[model samples]
Target chain A: MKVALDAMGGDHAPAVNIGGAKEALELYPSIEKIFLVGDEDAIRAECQKQGLSTTSPRIAIVHAPEVIGMAEPGAKTVRRKKQSSINVAMDLVKAGEADAFVSAGNTGAAVASATIKLRLIEGVDRAGIASGLPNEHGICHLLDAGANPEAKPEHLLVYAIMGSAFARHVLGVKHPKVGLMSNGEEDEKGTTFTKETFALLKGFADSGKAPFDFVGNVEGHDLFETQLDVVLCDGFTGNVVLKSCEATAKAMFKWLKKELTANAVRMIGAKIAKGAFVAVKERASAESYGGSPLLGVNGVVIIAHGGSTAVAVRNAIRVGMETVQHRVNPHIEATLQDVKR
Target chain B: MKVALDAMGGDHAPAVNIGGAKEALELYPSIEKIFLVGDEDAIRAECQKQGLSTTSPRIAIVHAPEVIGMAEPGAKTVRRKKQSSINVAMDLVKAGEADAFVSAGNTGAAVASATIKLRLIEGVDRAGIASGLPNEHGICHLLDAGANPEAKPEHLLVYAIMGSAFARHVLGVKHPKVGLMSNGEEDEKGTTFTKETFALLKGFADSGKAPFDFVGNVEGHDLFETQLDVVLCDGFTGNVVLKSCEATAKAMFKWLKKELTANAVRMIGAKIAKGAFVAVKERASAESYGGSPLLGVNGVVIIAHGGSTAVAVRNAIRVGMETVQHRVNPHIEATLQDVKR
Candidate 1:
């Protein structure tokens, strides 16, 4: 499979991208080629600095002059920076030159570029970003992480469909348990938007045509506590929950470290228990998941965190490859046909 | 100050309520009396079982025959179960028989009863729940936590006023730093609701009549990372973020404990580091905060967690006393008079 890496998109930029490409080539036999789309001179320098051979046939440099700033507005930046690395990488997928496009840059830009370039799959109203978070049972994909903030009830119904398809084909859940995010667990508890969404989802589930079981309304704690496969919510709510969980985890670890190093007794104990901490941290780290797939798009497009490391970038490429190999988009289109909302 | 406790509310019910009342009477000399509103037989039996003296002048039990179940609907139940503990407690505040009302009951029931019985403070269009969460600097109150799910732009404007008053007068911050909870930090990035709210807050800030500094649009991560006093959002978003943060912290601690006790060496280290873990746990506990204030009501009303412990109930009564002693409601009315949207 051919993959296009957004070499200039991310905090570490060309360095991590080049390193990731090298690692992907070494690790995956399925990767036929990796097109590094960025400024040729910068990519070449980073490859040389990182001791990655540019003469390898698996590695190719596709020079693109423009680079989108991390904090720039999403759709606007993508349109303005026509020759940017993100745009070029996405174009590779659009032209069928690459099987997937992966970026650890501005999420808005990637979503906009992918939606505009690749277009939504037929029968799909909107493309939602299904971001995965580790839970007790397994990963719970939070659909519409940030793609459609001003989503309607129909949009969420579609998200339920798309999220279920992703869970079944990609995450390997036999019968995904889906839920609607709300303030309360009761059926009548939600905003006007969510209440309308609830009725629609409940109707679909009652029809006996739902690919996944609709678990009704779920509270925030259910995300981590319950045995849920996909939790459906508007992009606005999903984004806040996602970021809040991330920040809380980060804050807890920070405080734990501070407390564990408060004195000699704790310091020694922390040293002895270092392996336990390392194991838990790795288990909880987003780096393990690598990236969130922008589902409902016509092709595979994965979005990693802005501050992604080389390891994270490599894992993102792997996620992109898996989405393609598993044929998640085609599965979604097929599922959508069986259940029309 | 005289305070009313909803003894029949919460997961633990009369047991925790009676125990908490006993502790509060012992701890606060400023608390003159506590009215325990619930079934007379149940309250008396629990008090006797816990060895609490019902003959004490500071303790009084008011009979409330009906009880509103934890899972019951809010407004409807509050009206139907007229003799419920939550209603009777709110009536105590309304009749000037108690200085404050405190409950570890159904949040929706408490909010409904308080708004209906005690009424809204003049110039307050709607009431909001300001739920506090501990952060790096201090506590950051999330306004409209669950009170007004379908909040308008003007409703959030009232939340800003009420939240600022709570932070300044009760939380004791000199100048509260308030932020609008959105998906991004950019001023233009938010749903239509949040954007409308942003404009109202920005206008209020620009007029130089605002008690707090408006920090434009803030993402979920900023709730912990930044030095924010209050974050304004619609009830639906605020509730989800609040619960998500709580759940994430709990999950992390649970994982850490499991990993730490996996082996004998790590178990020994964990035993030695137990103090550090205990300190962090207490620091991150909702029991420490006791309860969330249902702001903008006619009187001081506090809503504790449904799963609150005895310590939490005691702290909630303490919070009620502090709010009454601090004259938070009058201060809010005064602040609202100074700024009109």
Candidate 2:
């Protein structure tokens, strides 16, 4: 597979992205080439500093001088900066020069660039970000995690289809259990929008044509407690819920650490239990999953966290390759074609 | 202070309710009377079984013949079951016989009964539940925690005033710092509803007449990271964030325990560090705060968790007494009256 990565994306920029590209080249034999899209001078300097070969046949630098700021307005910045690395990288995917596009840059800009450049797949109303959350059973993907904020019930219906496809094909869930995010588990417990979405999903589930089992409604706690594969909600709610969970976990660990070091006895105990803490942290960290895929786009697009480390960037590239190898987009298209609606 | 307890409201029912009432009477010398609103026979039986004096004149059993099921529809059930314990307890407050009403029962039913019976306070359009979260600086109250789901921008403005009054008077903040919960901390990072609410709040803050310092937009992480006193949002978002945090905390502790007990060395360390865990758990426990106050109502209404233990019930009663003693409602009224808009 060929990939075009935004070399100047994320907080650490060229160094981490270059390091990730080198690691991906070493680990994955399937990668035929990687096009580093960014300022040529900076990419070369970072590549040299990292001890990576600048003349490697598998690596190529596509000079894109402009760089989008992390906090810049999404679509506007993408439109204004025609030579920006994110847009240039997306263009390569549109031209089929690369199999997938990866970025740890401005999330909004990455999303906008992908949608504008690649367009939407047939029968898809909007693209969504399928963010991964670690649950008891495994990983549960929450769709529309700040991609489509103002969505209709029909949009959510489309998200369920896309999310289910992503879970089954890329995430490898045999029969993905999809749920509508609501305030309560009861069928009647939701806002007007969720209620309407619930009706559509329930109807589709009753038709016996759905690829996944429809779990009527799920609460916020169900994200961790239930064995759900995919949970669907509008971007506004999904984003807030995802961030809240992250913050809570961070605060819990911080508090635990402070208390554990309060006395010598507890400190010694903490030393012995250090491995346990490290194990749990690695399991819970976003770096494990690497990136959230921007689903429903015509091409593969993976958006990594802006503060990604070199290891996280490597994993993100792996996720991008997996999406391509698994042919997740094709599965979504085929599944949508079977729907009567 | 006289308090009305919904003895038949919670999952534990009359048992925990009675046990809590006895404890509250012993703990607080200021409590003049406790009216246990439930079936007269059931309350008397539980009180007697718990070795409590029934004829001491301090504890009264009010006969509430009907009971509302936990899963019953909220407003409809409140209207249908006129003699339900929740309604009876709310009626006691509406009639000026009780200074506060406390329920560890169906949150929806309690909110409905309180809103219908006590009505909204002056200049308030809707009632909000100010749910507390233990943060780095102390506690940050999230407003509209499931009360006003479909809130307008003006309603959120009112929530800001009420939440500020709650934080300053009831939560003991000398000067409360309030924030609008959004997906990002930027000036333009929320849904249209939140953006409009931001404009209104900004206007109030700029006028130099607002009691609290409006801190613009804050993300979900700010709930734990920042020294915020109150964070305002619609009930739907607030409820989801709160439940997600609760679930995350539970999952973290469960995973920590499993990992810590995996080996002899770690198990020994876990035993030595058990005290630190207990201290942090207590610091983060909902039972410590006891209950969430349904603000913007005419009377003090505290809603405890449905599965509250006896200790939680006792704490709920204590919160009720504090809300009354602090004159929270009157302070809210006085603050709202000063606003020109």
Candidate 3:
């Protein structure tokens, strides 16, 4: 299996990407190759500096002339910068040269490039970004994290199906339970779009066309309960929820550390509770779940965090590889067909 | 000050409400009046069982003939059940018999009753539910928490103004900074509503009519940071973010406790780290911030948690009193007029 890595992406740049590529190659021996898509000279230099054996036959480089800044418009940048790292990596997946593509670049650029280059499945109208959130029970999937900000009821229905497919195939969940994220848990609690989407899901469930259980509306508080396998919402609400959770967790950990270091007694207490502290930190870490996957697209596309480190990038690559191995795209297409029929 | 308490509200029902009212009277000696609104017999029995004193000259009763179920339709229930506890309490505020009203009842019913009885302030199209999110860096006010599910850009602007006013007056922040919550921090990252709202806020900032500082768009991740005093968004996005944050904090605290009690060694460590644990718990506790206020209404209306205890109810009453004392409504009206002018 081959994976295309956008070495020019993320805050850590070529160094983190190179380190992650080395780690991925070591962990998965069956992974025959990695096509490092970026400025060839810069990536190679970073890899050499990291004291990695990049001279191996399995390692290769694909030069890209341009880079898309995080602030650039997604549609315009993807079209104008055709030779950008994201675009080039996506091309590798489209041409079947690489099984999957991983990027820690601007999310908008990565999403737009993937959708435009690899194309969407026949029945999929819009692609969604799915992120795994760690909850008390386990991990739950939130779809359309920030892809389409203004989604119609039909778009939400598609997200539900695609999210369910991803959960079942990649996350190893059987008979995944799907839910629409709304203001309240009741049937009549959401906006026009959510209400319409709920009706559509109900119809699909009654017709026995939906692949998983339609568990009705799930509120924000339900995200951490793991009551549903997949939580579906329009990009706007999903993004806000996703970002707020991330911010709150970071703030909580920061506050804990500050309070622990405030006095001598608390400092000693922090030392005594180091084990529990580590447990909490590990559970809240975003790197534990790797990167978000852009579902509904024809090929695998993983969008890692912009601030991703070596470990996060490696995890993202592994995620992309697993997605290909599990054939999530084809499964989503089949599910969409079922929902339509 | 006189407060109307809904005796038959919340999951705990008459017991919690009755006990809470007694505790409030005891805690706040200056609270001269209390009207227990519910079935006269049930409230009197509960008060007697708790061995509390409600025979003071300030104490009174307002019997509500019926109760609105939590699952009832907002508009229909509010209109039909005019004698419900929620309606009766709101009526006290409307009739100027009480300084403010407190309820741990159904949120929809509380909102509807408050809106119908108190009426919206002139120039304000709708009322918003505003909650104070307790983060590591103090508290940030989030508006339209679940009031209006489908909001226009103009509605968001109004929410921003109301949230700013509440934060400044009640939370004691001078020139509260307001932020428009969006998928990305970039100025152009939101949907049409977000983009237009951003432009409107910028225009306000440029024109010097806006009293608060418009801090530009804030991503969900910034909620914990004191980047802004008030965070503004439509009801749908705001509600999702609010619920998700609450759930995440609860789950994190629960997980920490469970991890600490796993074994004897950890248990001993927990004992040693009691101070640190308390610090963490206190920092994440939601009850510390009191209840969420419904803004833009003619009168002060606070929606306490449905599971509120005596302490929560008392704190909510204090919030209502503070809003009244600070003249938040008039301040908002004046500021809004300045913006229009």
Candidate 4:
């Protein structure tokens, strides 16, 4: 598979992206090619800085003049900066030169660029960003992570369908259980949007239009548990929960380190507890799931965080490859069609 | 201060409530009196079962005929069951016989009963439930935690003022920084409600109506950081984030235990890491916050979790006493008046 990587899109930029591309080429072997999209000279210099040469048969560069900052406005920046790294990388996916595109850049820009460049699948109103979080039972997929801040009930219904499709294809869940994120588990305990969405989901479940199990309402507390496979919500709530969890985990680790190093006895204890600490660290790391996938778009678009490291970038590339192999877009479109009919 | 304890409200009922009351009376020598509100026979029997005796100086029992189940509907149930433990406890607060009332009962019923029984402070449109979460920088308060699920922008502004007052008087943060929670940090990123709210908050800051620093917007990642002292949101989102954090912490601890007990080496390591583990456990535990206070009401009303223990109940009583001492209601009324004028 050929992947287009946004070489200048992340905090680590060309260095991490180039290093990850080199590693992907070395490990996958079957990954025939990678189009490193960024400014020519900068990309070349960073490749050398990382002790990597970009002259390999499997790797090449497609020079793009502009780079989108992580803080740039999504629609305005994406529309005006046509030759940006994200835009060019997505263009490669649209033109079928790359099976998937990966970027560790601004999530809003990535979503907007992908949707405008590659177009949405038929019957899909809006594209969503779906991220997988490690839960106590297993992994839970949270849909519409930040793509559409204010979504209608119809939009959420689409998220449920698309999320279910992604879970089945990527995680190998036979029949994903979908749940609506609400303040309370009862049907009457949510906002107007939630109430309307609940009724639509119930209709879908009763009619058996979708393949997944539509579990009623799941509260915020249910997110950490694998009570349902795909948890659906509007982007606003989903993004808040995602970022808060990340922040909390980071804060917990920082506090743990401080407490463990406070006294002589505890420092000695920390040495013996190293293995358990590693387990906890691994469980909290965001890179475990690589990047979130932009669902409902006509092609695969994977968005890693701007602060992604080499390992995260490499994981993102693998995710991109897997998404293409699993044919997630087609599956999503088919499910949407079934729901519509 | 005298506290009215609802002995019939929680899942554990008289056992936990009575035990908590006993602990409270024992722990806080400053507390002058306690009124155990529930069935007189059950309260007396449980006190005897624990081999604990409460003299007239420290404890008394108020007979109530009904108990609100955790699953009961809010408005109807609270009205019909006037003799319920929650109602009777509130009566104590209303009659000035007790400084405050504590209940490990249904949250909705408590909020409803409190709002109707202890009318809103003058010029305050709505009441909110504010819960404090421990953070590395300090404690962060999230208001409208689940009180008014369908809150308007004006209601959110009220929450901000009430939350700011709580942080100032109870949490002791001077000139607290208040933020409106939204999907993005940008002023224009949220829905109509958030956008209008952002403008209003900015106006308040410009006009010096609100004393706290009106930080423009905060994302979920700021929840644990010192970026904002208090976060303001409509009840729906606030409730979702609150529950999500709680559930995520619980799941993490559960995973940590299972992982630590997997092998003998790790088990021994865990034994040595007990101090560090306890620190992390205590930091994540919600009991430290005691319970959520229904702010904006004329009198002190605390809604403890239906699963609260003795430590939680005692801490809740302390919270009530502190609120009364701080004169939160009077301060709020004066602040609202100042804003209006």
Candidate 5:
């Protein structure tokens, strides 16, 4: 499938974006074309510096001069900067020129651009960002990680359906077990919103109308231990948990490094154990899973991290292509159809 | 100050409870007495096993025949088991016989007992648990960590007040900065509940009637890096964040250990780095904070972890004594009066 990548986005900018597109081209022959949507001059120079020629049959440059800085208001920027890289790239997908849109830009901008340009899929309450988090069993699809903070019970129900669809098609989980994120594990637990959502999910899952398995209420820590495929929550709670996990991991590693290098003996030992640490870090890194997908949109959109490296950007493209190849939108639409009735 | 210790509570039970009380007696000479409120026989045996005699003038065994199981329903158990260790100890505080009560038992039972017996201080809407979380800064106090899930905006307003009081008097901050936890740092970044709470908090702080500094909005990660004195949210959000952080830490350590011990070289390195790891673990541990205080209650009640060890139990007693000394409840009552009007 063809992909439109926002080349002027992320901290590393056009260089990593261009480098990533080139690597994706080499790795995935299935990626027919990558439209480098950014400032024309910057994209060309980065391609040249990286020893890549945009003249290649598979690589193409699409000029969109304006760049949305990371800190700018999302909806405002998208509206004002009509020719911004993010807006233009999304427009490409909306026009059916590209199967998917990928960006390591501002998440809010990405969500806004997609929501406004592509619009939400029919029967979907709101779009959500589904993130793949590492767990004991494998990876758990957590949504909406940040897309819609002011969400209702129905929005969460739609997230459950879309997240399950992604887990089934993209993550290759058969009969994925979906869970509602709550403070307690009991059925009687959760706020009024969650309680209402839980009843709907439970009824639907029990009736065998849905494709995924339903695990009633999963606590926060259960995300890592419970070998469930999909974990669902409102965007606000999901975002809080997601970032809290991120902060905790970052703090722990910092503490670990400080402790390991405190004394000479530990430093020597750290050398010996460097490989293991590297392996662990790679396994736990977000770059491995690429960007979170903005599900329930009319088209596929992958929202990568702002600090994404070349590999991350490449992986994001891979995720985007896979999402398109798996026909995630079609599947999500079909799954949500069952809920609408 | 006199403290009532629930000797039959927690996983390690009577032994640790007795041991902790004895240690607290030696460490804090201001502790006038400790009422070991539990089964008389079990308390005496544990005291004798730990080579301590109940005959000591400062130590006394208050016979409480009933025990509340961890899995028992909280409100019902508290009402039914009136002579339970938790209830009896809370009674010690209620009857003006003990300055404070500490328990490493069922959290629900602790909350219920504190609320029912001690009651909300004066005009407070509800009682909240103020938990100390270890972060980049020394500590960040997170309130309503697991108390009232159905918290209204006014309840949160009171939480903000009580949290600020605890931070200033107990934590010794000159002017505590209180933050409302949200999905984003922006003013308009939260659900309807949080939006209402945010508006109320902002108005109170801006009017200069609020004692603490109000930081508009804080994300989950900001808990560590921001160095803000107190973070306030509804209990559901706080509990989810709290447990998610705990789970992430546990999972990371498990992952690290698996990686570090995968081979002999790493194992040797781990041994060399053991000291640093221990130091980091101790620094990051919840045990160091004793236990979360059930804030806004009329009497001091420290809720220790159910899996608390002897040191944690001792620390809980220390916290209880400190809370009583600081007169946290009275201060909370006074601070909240500004908003109650």
Candidate 6:
């Protein structure tokens, strides 16, 4: 699969991006070619510094001088910076030059660029960011992680379909159990928006025409515990919930570390169980999953974290390639078409 | 202070409630009386079984013949069950016989009974549930924990005031720092509802007229860190966020325990550091905080979890007494009156 990666995206771009690209090529034989979309000189220098052959047939340079900043307004930046790496990379996908596009840059810019360049699949209202979060049962896909702040009830239905499609093929959940994020687990819980969407989805879930099992309602805490395959919510709640959990985990670990080192006896015990702590951290971290895919969009678009490391970037590229191989967009198009009926 | 205890509210009912009342009486010399509100026979039996003096001047039995089930509708149940323990306890507070009311029962019923009978304070539109969540930096109060599903910007101002008052007096947080819960830290990063609230809180926070330090936009992750005293959000978000964090912690501990006991070496390591784990659990558990106070009402109302144990019940009553002693309602009233002027 051919992929166009925004070379100057993330906080530590060029170097980390180049390193990740090289690693991706080495690890995945399916990645036929990668168009390193950014400034030609910077890309080549970083490629050489990272000990990768600049002339390698598998890697190509597509010079794009402009760079969309992480904090820049997304839609405006995408519209203004025609030559930005994010836009240029997406252009490659639009032109059928690459099967997928990856960026760890401005999330908004990435979404806007993909929406503008690749456009949305038929019957799709808006694209959603579907992030794979670590849960007790395994990974659960959280949609609208921050793509659309204000969404209509029908929009959530679209998210559910797209998320379920992504979970089934890309994430490999056989029968994804979909849950609507709400204040409570009761059937009547949630805002009017959720109530309307719940009614539609509940009916659809029972029709057997739906792609997954419909677990009526799920609260914030239920996200990690229940064996749910896909958790759907508006971008605002999803973003808030994701970050809140992240902050909680970070604080807990900080507290744990402080307590563990408070005394020599605790320190000795901590040392012995150091491996277990590391294991837990790894299992709980977002680094393991890398970027989330912007589902319902026409092309494969993966938006990585702004502070992504080389490992995270590599995994993002891997995700992009896997998404293309699974033909998620086509499946989503088919589902949306069915939904429209 | 005189406090009314709803003896038939929670899962364990009369036993835990009676045990908690006794414990509270022993722990706080200031507690003059506890009117155990429930079926007279059941309360007497539980009090006797728990080795409590029924005829003691400090402990009184208030007969409440009916009981509201956990799943009953909030307003309907409160109105229909006039003799329910929760209603009777709230009535005691309304009648000036009890300084505060504590319930380890249906949260909706508690909130409904408190709102309907005790009524809202001057200049307050609605009541809010201010839950004290155990964070790394002592405790942070999350308001509208599950009370108001839809809140106007003005309502949030009241929540911020009420929550700050509870924080400063009962929580002993001096010059409490308050944060408006949003999806992002930036001023512009929130739903339209949150945006307006942010602007108002931002001004109030700066005007120094507000009781708490108005720390602008905080994400869910900010709950345990940042030394923020009170985090204000609509009840829907607050409840979902609170429960989500709880679920995440519980699931993480479960996973940690499983991994630590998977092998002999890991099991030995876990055994050595059991104290540290126990200490960490204690720090994070809700039992340490007791119940959340339903603020903005005319009287002090603390609602414990429906599944609260004896220790939790004891803690809830203690919170109620402390709230009364602190005179949080008057302070909230002053803040609101000042805001209006």
- Chain B TM per candidate, please? 0.98, 0.97, 0.95, 0.97, 0.97, 0.96
TM-score of each: 0.98, 0.97, 0.96, 0.97, 0.95, 0.95
* C-alpha lDDT score of every prediction, in listed order: 0.90, 0.90, 0.83, 0.84, 0.87, 0.86
Ranking by DockQ: 1, 2, 5, 3, 4, 6
What are the per-model C-alpha RMSD values against the true structure?
1.3, 1.6, 1.8, 1.7, 2.0, 2.1
lDDT of 3: 0.83
Best candidate per TM-score, number? Answer: 1
Q: Which candidate do you rate higher for lDDT, 3 or 6? A: 6
Q: Looking at model 4 chain A, report the run of 10 residues with the lowest lDDT sum.
A: A220-229
DockQ of each: 0.81, 0.78, 0.71, 0.66, 0.72, 0.65
Candidate 3 C-alpha lDDT tens digits along B25-59: 87777677888899988888888898766687767
Between candidates 3 and 5, the TM-score winner: 3
lDDT string for model 5 (B1-341, tens) is: 89999999998898788888989998999999999999999888888888887889999899999999886767779999999999999999999999999999888888999999988788777899888988676578888898888799998888887888888888898788889998778887788988999999989888988888998899877888887878998889988998898888878778888988898988987787777778777866778987888988889999987778888899999888888888887787777665657
Candidate 2 docks with a DockQ of: 0.78
Q: For residues A1-341, what per-residue lDDT tens digits would candidate 2 score against the true structure?
A: 99999999999998889999999999999999999999999999999999889798899999998999888888789999999999999999999999999999998899899989999989988899998998899899888888887778998888898888888888789899999888777898888999999999999889898888999999877888899988999998988998899888888889889999999999988888888898888877788888899999999999988878887888889999999999999988888888846
Model 6 chain A worst lDDT window (10 residues): A246-255
On the 0 to 100 scale, the lDDT of residue B329 in model 3 is 89
Q: Write the per-residue lDDT of candidate 5 for residues A1-341, one digit (tens) a residue.
A: 89999999999998889888989999999998999999999998999999887788888899997999887778788999999999999999999999999999878888999999998999986899998888899889888898887788888878888888898898888888999988778787788989999998888888878788888899877888889888888888888889888888778778878888887988887887888778777766787887889999999999987878899899999999889999999998887776667
How well does candidate 2 score on lDDT at residue A48? 92
In model 2, state the lDDT of residue A333.
86
Estimate, for each residue in A249-275, the C-alpha lDDT of model 3 and write its tens digit: 877888778877888877776677678
Ranking by lDDT: 1, 2, 5, 6, 4, 3
Per-residue lDDT of A213 in model 2: 92
Error of 5 at A143 (Å): 1.4
lDDT of 4 by residue, A159-246 (tens): 8888888889988888889999888786777888999999998898898687789988898667777557888898888888888777
What lDDT is reached at residue A214 by model 6? 89
